[model samples]
Structures are given as structure tokens and as C-alpha cells.
Target: MRRFRHFTSSDSTSEINISPLIDVVFILLIFFIVTTVFVDEAGVEVNKPRAASSEDLEKNAILIAVTANGRVYQGGRNIGVGGVRSVIAALLEGDEEMPVIIQGDADANHGTIVKVIDAAKIAGAKSVSLATVK
Candidate 1:
């Protein structure tokens, strides 16, 4: 009687298996896609002053409106000068580098516009700009 020996091959590989990593990445992508909140502007109608050289501004900016009556508004809601700082501070909590645009009525008081600018700066905004009509 002859004894037969069985031969087996071994997998001695040092490379990492990346299939699980790829799956995790895909799952994260899907989670972000589903859980991300998109902010859309919904506010009072502003009668923006018209300007011949007004350029188109980038959307999704922090708008601070100064009405002709010296009233301040943020996101279309009435916010007085004292409240401006707090509102801007709240908005900047997520992004301190957020841009602020002051949309003052052409007939609005210059002093009011200045106050808005000052409040925006105090709120830690990187850039504070005026909004002009085009």
C-alpha cells in the first residue's frame, strides 16, 4: 500500500484589505448627503437701491439691512442696533469667517449704516461690505 500526500497553497500576503474602508467611506458620503441641512433665505422684501455700476454679489451672504427709517434687519427680521451684535455673533458661531453685507437704503441714514458695519466687525466677521444697487 502506497501513502499519498496532499499539497496546499498558503496566502502569505502583507497587503491590507481595503474593501471595508471603501464601504465605510461610501456610508459616510450617504449620511452627509442625507443629513446635511441646506439654508435658504426667506424674509421680508427689501427695496434695494438701484445703481448703474452695482455688480452681482455672491449668494448666501449674511445680509444686514438698514431701512430708510434707520431700522436694522437681519434675515428680513427687525433687529435693532443693540440686537445686531448678538444676532451677528450667533450667525458667526458656526463660521467666524462668514462675509457680512450691509444693504442700506439709498435714503437710509449714514449713521445707521456705520452702526451696522461696526456691529458686524464686533461679531468677528472676516469681511464686512456694503451692498449697492446696480
Candidate 2:
């Protein structure tokens, strides 16, 4: 009876302190905000082909897209293969190890893809990958 009375006593503090929990949640939120990486897409949207061997790529890589009509876009600008070479050359000057990824529409011409890859290589891009959906 004494133990029950103690548990039921109004003098006992029964409120849960949530300040620490709130502080922890805020810290986690800030950490996620700082570590988040936003993917920047080229201006054009392409229906990427499906490939079973497709793999994830680094978020920092440059994205190049070839529309079904064979027009190329980079950084929201219409830059053809010639522009790709020049732009990639400038980018490689800053960071030679930067990778380039090409997003080609499923119905886009194969020749265009090859041309973009060749342009990237000519611009001193050590790593060039084709983007595809899995």
C-alpha cells in the first residue's frame, strides 16, 4: 500500500522530458540537409532504354541528353556534339577526373550516341557512360 501511494502521489513528477529528443531530431534534420545531393538534369527529357546491367552513377557527373529528334542538351541549353566537346573541354580543365553521362532516348539514333561519346572522349573525358534505366 505504501508503494502504491508513492506511485499515485501528486508530488511525483511524471512528465516525460522531450527537449533532448527534439534536439536530436533537429540535429538529424540538419545533417540530412547538409548531405543531400540534388540531381541536375539536362534540358531535354529522354525515355531511357532499359538495361539489366545499368548501375548507379556519381551525383556530380555532368548529364547530357539526346532527344528522339537527335538534338542534344546540356545544363538546360541546346548544345550539339560540337558544343559538347567545347563544354567538356572547359569542364575537364577544372577537374579532369569528372565523369560524363549521356542520356539517350530509346528511339534516338545510335549514331548520335556514338557521336556524343566520341566528342566526350575528344574533350579528354576519362570516364563516359551511357545512362539507362534498369
TM-scores of all candidate predictions against the true structure: 0.63, 0.71
Which regions of candidate 1 are displaced past 4 Å? 1-42, 51-53
Residue-level lDDT tens digits of model 1 in 57-110? 554578787888888887768888888889888988987777888878788888
lDDT over C-alpha atoms for residue 66 of model 2 = 93
Please list the C-alpha lDDT of all candidates, in the order they appear: 0.79, 0.89
- In order, what is each prediction's RMSD in angstroms? 7.2, 5.6
Worst 10 residues of 1 by lDDT: 38-47
List, residue by residue over 12-41, the lDDT tens digit for candidate 2. 677899999999999999999999987777
- In the predicted model 1, the residue pairs found to clash are 51-133
* Candidate 2 local lDDT, residue 75: 86
